[model samples]
Target: MHNIPIRNLSARLVDPFQREYYYLRLSITDVCNFRCNYCLPNGYQPHPERDKFLNVDEIRRVVRAFAAMGTEKVRLTGGEPTLRKDFVEIVENIADMENIHTLALTTNGYRMAKDVAAWRKAGITSINVSVDSLNSRQFHRITGEDKFDDVMRGIERAFDVGYQKIKINSVLMKDYNDGELAQFLAWIKHRPIQMRFIELMQTGEMDHFFQRHHLSGQLLADKLVQQGWQLQPKGRTDGPAKVFSHPDYQGEIGLIMPYEKHFCTSCNRLRVSAKGKLHLCLFGEEGTDIRDLLQSDNQQLLLQARLFAALQGKREHHYLHQGDSGVRTNLASIGG
Candidate 1:
């Protein structure tokens, strides 16, 4: 039995697992501009109505409700958040909220050059750009799009603005960009950003590409050290990433090892889909539609019930341990 007081959402303000989860990943849209081979298969079809996304007002209301229940950080993600017509409007609304300490975005960076200023004014100070490779051929091969130039322009422009802690998220593939890890490190050493090496989990469109070259985070780190890289433990976060850095290297490296091991015990985060479904775990195929409860007659009571339901819904660990591809959802559609 826990003695902590229940907040507005009937959230015990403490998870049963003993972790204080204060961050919420909100997927505002399921649409994306680029069709990364790993994210979606070749025959992938975009959502029919990308314009029919969750309105800014609804997003704010939900953010406020979650904040009341101890949500202090929020990240706006999508197939591409920049692709949203009112993406800036949504960020502005969340940033103005008194309770939210951080409001960030994860994008392919195709439109960062155009939206960095607006995003900064709207209350998003940090941004994560997904760049799979620096080589043009590899870039096109990975993203299946030729918008690499646009993405590069976005990165430069983002740094030009007040946006600091700019992070480059690279999903490592087995046979594809596995050998270019050193090139990635060399590039980041001179820049003012953090380069992240994410272990590709066997899931989504990449399921077919899983065994071709599944590299562990440890292997990547070992390679980094072999390249005359000096690293030290930086810190930890709710998500994946065992962070390290090189001496005098302005940027650091984050190694996200979600599938290699599980961190469910201290996990205290929940993700909300664009359509208002609350996910207890990323690999969860089923979710409690908190949208209905939030709009019900007795919202407060319903909210508490929803919280309890979400907690009870939390599986002890993700099914990845079964020797299967652990990633259950697309990273872009879901907030990474």
Candidate 2:
């Protein structure tokens, strides 16, 4: 499937500011199994109206609409996408689209052992596994679950299935996993997986969470350098990671500092929530409701027009830490 030739869209999809968006983060469900402290805290209730979410056919048509507008890649996210009953079907259908060049998955890795091979067969080219803490006790504390061993098994299965580009996404918090930096660096010394450390962002209930626990990726990298780890720049870039490789390590280490806002400059992706809202920025509360357009009389034409209008109104950057700006809903609902 990697050999599938590319084709150009008749009309390119460009934002009002002239930024070409070629990436789409499509969330299939808002239901998840694990509740991470920063994302879904205790007593968090799931979105009750499951019937309101788009079904398989609606998802296919919506993906095609985005693909037709020059969306080169689609990354499936969720509260946990594997929690979707039709996860395989949804992924395969999107993978079958001719205009979409790549399909990816961002999962909690709780079900990777059972689903990774099927996802790979369905044309998923890359994966991001959320593993906040390597220590089982810390993992349970951070994610409100005792599934650290399960996640480890999932990662092993993903690797055994030949996913060389597996990325481990760790959300760094000062009082939490911040001290695990050395442990993570050592863990990647002989593995092929890329370790990406992300600075905790002020999202949802985590708005106040970051002020106390936020950890800087720059500080971590600088610490690694001070500890005598040689860091060299890696060629090529994808998504928002700042990639670096150590001479003695087999895997690369990456940093994503959302607070610094460096990644916003080359922002090329848009997000579609499970409820069919097109969110131009991760921190935006308001979005154009594309679900209604998808169910309308002339979906194709209407979807095209609605998407353009949404993109035209897209914010240039998210103001999460400043003023009173930031999304109000939990990350699960917004598919972060």
Candidate 3:
């Protein structure tokens, strides 16, 4: 609490590898309604207890500390962040922070239909909707729920609520939704939304899931190019997605290959799980517990020091292919 002075806007959380992190993916809760086969298998139990999650005040202070340290963007994630009762209040508080220039959200789009208007009013810059399969029956099979109709309605409601640039995220699986690539491309031909085809990662339950359904995102992109779609650069410097748009269509497409192609060199984000654990890498097993540290005295300085220490040791790239990394918690438990 007595050493380095707070640098405010000029401060950057630089890791030993020299990558500066200015984006924070804050998980509000680990509780989710949908039980996706890829994220949560039959026996997997997420953070089912609400009391264990960080309180609204704790969340506000944590974000404020990061904001002071030059966090320009904050994306609210969760098992489903909108499932939390204080979802609106949390967004509002983050929006009020001076240093946060952009606020984005990633959701399964289950409850977004009912809350899109509130999200629009709260200054949410953009949204990423995880719609794995467009087919109703296959959607139910993959997600273990029949909310496909509801999710589609939510995406439509987001457009109606004035969300200009909505992104659709679909995890490609070999035997699952892989056959829908052409269908997905056709569906977005005239739509304004950018559909991103993500490579299925080897996360928690995904080890077994990968055996039956691991499709490469690069192959899908090749097919798009073969079909005469112009792969123009998106010019976005922040996210991991390699975005491309076509001249003939109104919509755009992207590919996120965290497994096949790791973009860790340009990785500039940190994740805070619902239980207040600060994760330097998405696949990292070690993390600093902010929940306990926040309860300590001289919170600002303490948080600053701890955060800086965490950054100093941030790994250059996550060891996903290595056996050590696959033994972590469920993907839903980590964040969306």
lDDT of each: 0.72, 0.79, 0.79
Least accurate stretch of 10 residues (summed lDDT) in model 2? 1-10
Query: How do the residues 1-336 of candidate 3 rate in per-residue lDDT, one tens digit apiece?
Result: 323343563346888887777889998887777778778756336434545788777787788778778788899988888988988988887686776888999998988889899988987888999999989999999888899999999999999988877899888888889888768878888889899888777765567777788877888778878877666653322678877777877788888887654568788888898889898877876678878766643587678778888788877787775644544657776674
**Candidates 1 and 2, the one with greater TM-score:** 2
Candidate 3 pairs with clashing backbones: none
Candidate 1 clashes: the total is 2
User: What's the candidate order when arranged by decreasing TM-score?
Assistant: 3, 2, 1
Better of 2 and 3 by TM-score: 3
Per-candidate RMSD, Å: 4.2, 3.3, 3.1
Model 1 residue 48 distance off true place after TM-score fit, in angstroms = 7.4
Residue-level lDDT tens digits of model 2 in 1-336:
222333542356688778888888898888788879888876347555545677887787678778878888899998888888888888887787876777988998888888789889978889999989889999999999899998899899988998886899999888889878778888898998789888777765666886889877888778767766565553222677777777788888888877775557778888898888888888875877888777643466678778887788877777764734465567786666
lDDT for 21 (candidate 2): 82
Q: Model 3, residue 165: displacement in angstroms?
A: 1.4
- How do all models score by TM-score? 0.88, 0.91, 0.92
Q: What is the lDDT of residue 112 in candidate 2?
A: 88
Q: On a 0 to 100 scale, what is the lDDT of residue 184 in model 3?
A: 84
